[model samples]
Target: MQSIQIETEYVTLGQFLKMIDVIGSGGLAKWYLEEYQVYVNGEIEQRRGRKLKPGDQIEIPDVGKFEIIE
Candidate 1:
């Protein structure tokens, strides 16, 4: 797993995806979220606006895992 640092108190799923270079834009992130599988701390997640804060973990199949830090 890798770690990503965020400056805000929280980051939305779509924003995080783009920040990590997983997707080019929020639109692509939305489309990717709908077309692919994503998980938050081990549970399936589909919401683009899902709040991700420090200590949160996001996993994208075939891509990798990311741990959030502030």
Candidate 2:
């Protein structure tokens, strides 16, 4: 599990990806999302713009898992 530091109420999957620099840009996120390489709460998430709140867990399969934190 991993934690992401944030000073906001919540973060979207797209924003989180950007904050973590996982992908180069929004375009890349979209491509990856279309490929279904992203997962949320143990399920494949094809929506790059999925909203994520504290306590939400995101799993990127071979990549890794990101646990939202306060």
| Number of the predicted model whose lDDT against the real structure is largest | 1
TM-score attained by model 1: 0.94
Reference-based lDDT, each prediction: 0.93, 0.80
Clashing pairs in 2: none
**Model 2 lDDT per residue over 1-70, tens place:** 8887677788878888877778787777887777757778878877777888888898886777888888
Clashes of each: 0, 0
Would you estimate the TM-scores of all the predictions? 0.94, 0.84
Residue 47, candidate 2: how far off, in angstroms? 1.2
Per-residue lDDT of 13-70 in model 1, one digit per residue for the tens? 9999999888998989778888999999999899999999999999999999999998
Alpha-carbon error at 33 in model 1, in Å? 0.9
Give the Å shift of residue 26 in candidate 2: 1.8
